[model samples]
Target: MTETPSTMQMVSFAAWRDGALHSGRQADRRYVTLAELLVRLGSFGLGLSWKARLFDRQPHPAFAQMVKASAGSGIPTLELLATDAPYRQAVDGDFEGYAGSELALTLREFDSSCWEVRTADAWVLSEIQRHYPDARPMTSDEWDTTT
Candidate 1:
């Protein structure tokens, strides 16, 4: 089932990253649903497995992108994240990512709730977005404008 970006609506990136803590401008792009993203990247099997593991819990597509970004930024492993995710709770406080990795990269979801976490660094995104379709980072305008 290949879904288009026009079909679904996503939560705002600001909603997830808010308050004085929020830094760096977020890009404006539409996100694909979890199913669409899985099919987009041929990661359906993994998505399904994760869905099953989570008992089909928040089946939104954004999660896949979250996992991808977190790992790429070397923030922390999902296994560690599982210890404290924003589900069924007030989200055990903020997650200040480890610095010194020099990773200006972060994750951002689209209005469709589909997302990718790539560097806020424009030069890097232009080079990498093509290779990793789902995880491509882009400038705000580039993200907003449909190619």
Candidate 2:
């Protein structure tokens, strides 16, 4: 297995349709690696059966693939969204899960060249920056902003 990259940009878009947690309608960024990213991602499945499957002290299989896929790209990353905040916080100080297990599973199950591939096989950060070049690094104070 490849050593997880030390750090990668984490881009979090908000989930407006998801309700309350989605109220903080700002995308954000932070640096993280496979370990933390898994916890952060797994948190999304919190209270669900998949929660255990989402996080592992070691990277989960799905997450490992994501790490490997991103590692070969220009910017190693595990892109997620703001709807993930509560899950991340619920993990008891473990910044493990991010809110994209569905995306991860889709990528893992489908052909990379398939039209359905959501990420279009591009570096996630590239995709984010391509669409929202104005996104800046997030500050703790701005974390709760609903804009």
Candidate 3:
């Protein structure tokens, strides 16, 4: 059975960057749980299996992008399956561990761009609010009317 997603509200923040409409700044995006905020925690750790660790330590840019996509898709957690990955089955040895290999595979095969954008926006807003308590989310009108 598929697990139902928990009730999670996502806030967003937007700012001018590099004089561009879509700056695509990395640090400008972030996300966290409301409960986590209450306790002053930003992220949760997901222990990976040995196989998954192989890709995780030095993940390619695409790999990181895929992770963002998954997170955006409401994947609360990424799990490493017990089965061996077909990609590296030939070099298989005593590689027994629950790594996030399944997640990697899924991301590589699927596309979740829309979800990624949505989640990333929320993440950025959350981070900004967390770091700058006084800095409020602004509207186009507010920005224009300010100065």
Candidate 4:
């Protein structure tokens, strides 16, 4: 088995729907962070009968509030994240999961059109890149400016 890194660094990328890079809103694209993706994988098993197959943790307090409000108001989670101030604040706060001694992996939505997956695990990053041939790495400057 491959050894996991002691400290993981975030990798940012964009997956274009067209399988090619485009400029200036010309094509449908999803901005993804490696950590968010991992959390999503964990979340998929939340209501299942089997034990969660991926890392799982209680959501941040603010995030839990947004979830409660979204359920009561019948607003979609994505819509809540996009339009609700409290949801945005919760997202801005620490909301990622960490494994062992690795750094926290944050899950955030930059455009609010989608929730990007983020990961600090190199193995996960490599697997995602292999599976997603259309995904391209985002430079630190690009990631910083957008986030």
The digit string of per-residue lDDT tens for model 1 on 6-72 reads 4222212222312233358565443232333223333211222221112133533444344444544
Task: Give per-residue lDDT, candidate 1, residue 43.
Answer: 20
Give one digit per residue, the lDDT tens place, for model 4 in 1-147: 122343434453343234355676565554443233433444431221110111114545545554455332233323433433332322222233333333234444444333333455556556556655544555445545645
Clashing pairs in 3: 30-123, 30-124, 31-123, 49-98, 49-99
Give the alpha-carbon lDDT of every model: 0.32, 0.28, 0.27, 0.39
For candidate 3, what is the total of clashing residue pairs? 5
What ranking emerges by lDDT with the best candidate at the front?
A: 4, 1, 2, 3
Q: What residue runs in model 2 are displaced by over 4 Å at the alpha carbon? A: 17-122, 132-147
Error of 3 at 57 (Å): 25
| Candidate achieving the largest TM-score | 4
- Clashes (N, CA, C under 3 Å) per candidate: 4, 10, 5, 10
Q: Write the per-residue lDDT of candidate 2 for residues 70-144, one digit (tens) a residue.
A: 332212122432223322222111122223332221111111111111122235445444544443444323322
User: Candidate 3 overall Cα lDDT vs. reference?
Assistant: 0.27
Model 4 pairs whose backbones collide? 33-117, 33-118, 34-118, 34-119, 35-118, 35-119, 36-117, 36-118, 37-117, 37-118
Q: Which regions of candidate 4 are displaced past 4 Å?
A: 1-36, 39-94, 113-120
TM-score of 2: 0.21
Among the numbered candidates, top lDDT falls to: 4
